[model samples]
Target: MSATVSPDQLPLQRLYHWERTAPNRVAFTQPVGGGQTVDYTWKQVVDQARRMAAHLQAQGIGAGDKVAMLSKNTAHWMMTDYAIWMAGAISVPLYPTLAAGTIRQILEHSEAKLLFVGKLDGWLGMKPGIPEGLPCIHHPLAEADAKKSYPGWDDIVAKTAPLAGEPVRPADDLSTIMYTSGTTGAPKGVMHTFANFMAAVAAGLERIPQNEGSRMLSYLPLSHVVERALVEHGQLQTGMHVYFAESLDTFTTDMQRARPTVFFSVPRLWVKFQQAVNHKMPQKKLDTFLKIPILSGIVKKKILSTLGLDQCIFAAGGAAPMPAELLAWYSKLGLNIAEGYGMTENIGASHITTGDPDSFGTVGRPYAPVQCRIAPDNGEIQVKAPWNMLGYYKQPELSAEMFTDDGWLKTGDKGSTDAQGRLKITGRVKDLFKTSKGKYVAPAPIEDKLVMHNAVEACCVTGANLGQPLALLMINAEATAVVKNGGKAELEASLAEHLKHINETLDPHEQLDCLVITSEAWTVDNDLITPTFKVKRNRIEDMFAKNYDRWVGMRKPVVWHG
Candidate 1:
């Protein structure tokens, strides 16, 4: 990392740089359906943001005021965030899929002065959470009813004069309050300064190396810390051309259009991509093709092209543990997926894999100037970084608990460092469960192995007081459809074989009692998984703990649950 970073490298400062240096360069490309797209030049992006900043200031949103954003990733979503900062306000972003109660909790807790609504699929369900009389500005991509109800972005920009001159914010000023997509409990607002954001991006760029010619596709929820730091701040730093996905149905088209030089996604999406490829070309057939010397290169190229990652120079997976098997699979296909480790607390800069075969399963060395260690007492991973959060907003007691007597942030993840200083996370301290036999098992590792099977989408391994742990598996949509069509016998036989293979690798106590194939899907709507696709263990317990004994006592290797 650079020893001294100029204040000029701050997000707003970088935006100003691009606006002046390359006013005509395309900054954002937005899909508008029907095979059409709209491009926003740097000048256009800055102009709209400037006018919106003036509008926000006119409404008394200045000097640390909190402005909330509720939307999916869109060009205007980034624009609105810039506008909030220009108004001397702290931006608070909400995940677009948040339920009404959680939505209301965050808005009321942050005491947001205003809200920006954009590109939401569930506005009607989420609208009840917004307190009446709170001012809102709608992005053009917002829901139809929301557009009719709130002041539109174009309308406000048209009426307001652009703020003149280069208004500067101090480096230490609060920039954004990112609420965690809580997997266990209520969301906590993670506060970050402008300098924190800049430091994280700088450390990242020191290794990843993006420039003006870099292209990125923004589809991950920008509300997440990884996306906020990598895509939004990365673009601001390097003048990357960002493309937005119009919808899930058109994601492939959007990816082909962007041909992003840099791409990041969670493990679930990576698994889905592999599943899609296997659906088209069975893994057995693909493997056989790759063994032929002449056809190997051609086969790899065709597969990457089909997945729209043929031009991707850097691809990463984070926000959860990526299965080593999955990484090896992509490695064979000529795409090396770097696994990164970070949390909302660290501004998503801690460690990343170095693309070394020796560092395959470990998150490679920590970024420069970031210190990482395992706690002597509980084995929790603790980190001290320039970009660590100020603390959880307005929760002084909880914030105090998040750190040690010194300043290291307690990451809650149990991990160890290798001889080369790479990190290998074992499990969450709180995620370990002791069974009736008094042997504690970390479910994440076992669940990682189970999810490698094609039929499983998401899973949870839990027992608590039972004799042994058991797994609750949610078969993926395609497999579920096949089961509904009466292919249960074959699916059951396949899962039983997979279960036997997995258990053979484990000690008797650590082996699962049974694999219960769940009837219901685990989704955000059902409160069984976070928006980032991490399974909620507590929710899984609430829904299935009552049946643990029955599941284990069934005396079958695989049990089908209704």
Candidate 2:
């Protein structure tokens, strides 16, 4: 009766079956250098994964071995992932953009033996990294810098036997050790089994109509569990077309070409996509046009084309809070953009907003298999599910703190349930900040409202003793990249308008008293954001502490220090 095979088989076993069933069908379509996406069939991918599995076993990687991967989102990345499980070793995924110190902490924490590096920017050379003989993998000469020397990925895969005996992979065996980013302290490794991965795939497919015929465009990093469980496992079962964005710059053009029926994105990217539509026809113009009723359809159609959400039915937003305003705006354009909430500890698939219109603001109800409860004392969300992680890899003290004695996984997010039982995440219990007056301000909800503004690409909310509500905002690079050669004045005016709009939408206390604009991007490396792309509040505040007064003196509605 289940959608998957016997629970006794490993995920790699399921993958081998899909290859036989749909041999020539496309498995993953990765991006090439200049505006091109390439495809690999299911059979070819499986054969390579098996060969890689064979090669890994030859290198002494068998059951219980932990193989760590630090790579960007690519076909080779996911293929190597299956190879690890196929060989019965646990997969340890490291965020490609993590700081060297953080990477060192995680690899050391997980006690990873082998690390495969796909392609990295300059930061890969930083010290205290994965040591030599760990077998670092890199892309061909294209992503490599001649000056920067490291082990090549091709040489290792080449050394692997093209064929080998079947590995003893079991369903209950540990499949991955996913390290979750900590809000208050160091990260922890969350262990998940092969059955957890497959069950999540089955449960997720119940929400959307995904199959071999359905196409998926994966923009999120493969390291994240939700992306991996859905895009990676679903492809093995369905022989679906999986296309990667050419580059972050050409993601929009890539979306249009892929014309994906099933798509997933983080809440931050979802907000920017909605804002892009608003910039084309400012809110005033849209309101005025909607009043006409006649021109509204035409105007909305044009706007949808610009945002490239013209034909996507299975669009989802996760990892952070999504504003009610932006969700309604896209819903009007006939997009099925729904909001969901989850943490890495749960294999990253949890409560999700349903396709039904009534399920709007709520993260919808929990999946049938997942039982969630609001804890009595501090309102921490707790999950009791079969797919829940076993414990932290080696930290018993941390692991004991994560669960109740009765077996509930304590999620630090604060939430409440509506009458219909749909879950609404009020805020994060840990992310709530105390003002100088000791008034608690939850930044997640406030940050959600501010990012709805078009020119505001990313923002972090912070205020210590002296400063009023200050937000460090990064301008939308894609929009500014095309302010054409000499359009600095126009870009400034647009950014000014965006700051004004965001300020007007907030309550008096929650209003951003000052805005810090910077051209330098906020990413995991610079320590401004997390692996899941959430802002690092402490780092942002420290970075701007000296220049905080200069922004307030500008007399502008917001600060522009770039």
Worst 10 residues of 2 by lDDT: 1-10
**Lowest lDDT 10-residue stretch of candidate 1:** 1-10
On a 0 to 100 scale, what is the lDDT of residue 366 in model 1? 91
Residue range 1-562, candidate 2, lDDT tens digits? 1123365334666676766677887777877777656778877777777777777777788878888887777888888888887777888988777777778888877777777766455544543576545565554422544224555556656666555544546566788888776544577788888777777777777876787788888767778887887788777656678887666778788787777878788877777776766766678877888777778788777776666666666888888777777788777766767777677777667788875567776899887788889999988899877777777888788889989989888988899999998998878777667656656666767777667767677888777553356778886765567544676567667656766777687665566666677768887767777877777777777778777667766766655566
Q: Provide C-alpha RMSD values for all models, in order.
A: 1.3, 3.8
lDDT of 1 by residue, 1-562 (tens): 2223579998899999999999999999998769899999999999999999999999988998999999999999999999999999999999999999999999999999999999998799999999888888899989999999998999899999999988878888999999998889999999999989888899999878588899999999999999999999999999989999988898898889999889999999999998888888988999999999989999999999988999998889999998888899999998998999999999879999966556787888899979998999999999999888888999999899999988898999999988878899999999999989899999888888999998888888899978888999999888988888999899999999999999998888889889998888898888999989999999999988888888788899899888
Number of colliding residue pairs in model 2: 0
- After superposition, candidate 1 runs with Cα above 4 Å error: 1-4
Candidate 2 yields a Cα-based lDDT of 0.73
Runs of candidate 2 exceeding 4 Å displacement? 1-5, 8-10, 35-37, 123-128, 139-142, 145-160, 164-168, 286-308, 355-357, 464-468, 478-512, 518-520, 545-557
